[model samples]
Target: MKESLYKRIARELAQQISTGTYPPGSLFPTEMELCEIWQVSRHTMREALRELTEQGLISRRKGAGTRVCEPPTSGVNHPLSHLEDLLLLAKNNLRVIKKIDEIVADIELSQLIDCPPGSRWLHIASIREDAQNPDAPICWTDSYASTDYARLRTFIRDDPHSLISDLIETHYGIKSHEVHQTITAVGVPKKIAKILNVEPDSPGMRIVRRYRDRDGKVFETTISIHPAGRYTCSIVLKSQNSGE
Candidate 1:
């Protein structure tokens, strides 16, 4: 497996743009200049530049030379560094428990949580509010955990700041080895809309997280719904070569 010369050039240029070497609105080298510098033909240089243009990294015109554009960043506010950060989000907020019930997952619930239809679970429903601004709710969350830890219900009600997964680990001595998450754009349901004080079918973000134990068995599933502009998720990525 070998890398093509044009693609390699495109990657190098992209790195420069990302690293602010060629900042936004700055002029980029001309095709002839790049061809001469890289010792490549006009076609190869054109292809490389075209790749960057298509990625919205740069713009070019006949008379106006190519210029870098502002790099796009995901609308993020809080940067989650590790599992503790994830738990901190729940611990820092105030969760007002709406209801707790024992149930068997039906067909729809099974698909949503990625669990068997006949699985028994303890469902805890709550609304998270900012500690300082309790008047404005943040999101609605539904957490389903294995009924084996039903004793956790009392503790959950008493401790509104602790996450169920954390509680499970504390009481049952079972730790989460990994967590799988999925985020989707959805409309706020009618029931949730009223509670959140938003319009029905309004824009919302649906986030589902599955917590697994060391045995790779899913022990808990949580679904959270946040109104548009209410929450922003962020993550930092690094390259292996950059020893930081």
Candidate 2:
């Protein structure tokens, strides 16, 4: 089967991005330029750009031209990968400005946080705003921490700029030497859809992160979901030795 022209265009542009021909944080060609270069109609060019945007590769503004976004990381490179990193790569570019704390021990959550049944756990709920549009929320994150790290609460409140792991290590001397991540696709629940401004049952990606300290104890676990249209995760592989 032959692929559509729009798909071909999108794939070519994506290859450029992955190869660094169109480096991150750079401006993409104008729509008119794309139309001219591809010899396609304006509508087809727009569709190609939309595909790129939905894949989280580029951002377009009314005044500013489309801009390439930063590459997405697995949160493994840094002890604490801030939400900002993902948001910057998000199509909507949401910002998390406030964090609220609570305590919960729901049956399912207890297991996820690695605490015993009925064990007390710290919870942090945050609302993130689209960087390009402040009025809308791109997504929401609810995080849980073990009771032993309760004293680290103030660290999160005082320094919202730091990654959660960094805050934990800085305040309680618990370092996350290992991290486990799992990703899955799910339909948006009604409550989450309301918060994310998407229709109920919309497609979304759920990412679960478990952070383990130097002693191999689980300190923190977070579950975050983003609307499918809002984010993209890509990986590039390079061969170390070729043509042997």
Candidate 3:
């Protein structure tokens, strides 16, 4: 079947973005201009732009025309509606390590990471930042890795884009069968607030992700705190019988 006109236009716009023809933060052509260029109706152009917005590729505002934006990991707009978007988050941000230490999980730590109290863990503190804007950190993260993967510290220090669970799978053959995630609204702690360039006790979102192996063992857990206004999470819901 032939692709719909709006879908074709959306694909063309995405390609233009990927090729840097329309760079991030650059203003996209107005709806009228786009309609004229493609010789399509206003409704067709609107749908085309809507498709790009849903893909996290552009932002639209009443006074702001349309603006090309970076993928979710850059914090312009984060769409958690699909697995691919989660992978994109890991691919786009670079995690810069600040410190690493081996310690036994105490009661508080165990509850925080959802691990056993007595289990040994390698605590890795890092700050993730957008590759394009490294000076302004995106979030402060605390990662806890199973002691079995202690060598991950060295590898993680050397590489920034690779997730620890992925590295564990690559080096130790421990595949991640599932991931448990939780999101909470919290305040930015004073200790890491300065690093994240946010004030202490400011509104923030704390995201906790735990990667579990086939046997349901948690191998890696990361808690990330993103300041408000720096991140926006968009969830898309589809109808079960939307085929019609």
lDDT agreement with native, every candidate: 0.80, 0.66, 0.80
* Model 3: per-residue Cα lDDT over 107-152, one tens digit each: 9989988877898888889987865667667788888987888788
| Reference-based TM-score, model 3 | 0.71
Rank ordering of all candidates by TM-score, starting from the highest: 3, 1, 2
Q: Considering lDDT, which of the candidate structures 2 and 3 is the better prediction for this target?
A: 3
Better of 1 and 3 by lDDT: 1
State which candidate, 2 or 3, has the greater TM-score.
3
Candidate 3 lDDT score relative to the true structure: 0.80
lDDT string, candidate 2, 26-143, tens digits? 9999999989989999988898787677667789998988899897652211111323223223222333634555676778877766677776777776655554445445556677
TM-scores for every candidate against the unseen true structure: 0.67, 0.57, 0.71
Name the 10 consecutive residues with the lowest summed lDDT in model 1.
72-81
**Model 3: how far residue 54 lies from native, Å:** 3.4
Per-residue CA lDDT of candidate 1, range 115-205, in tens?
9899899999999886545655778999999999989889998888878898998889888888888999999999889888889999999
* Models ranked on lDDT: 1, 3, 2
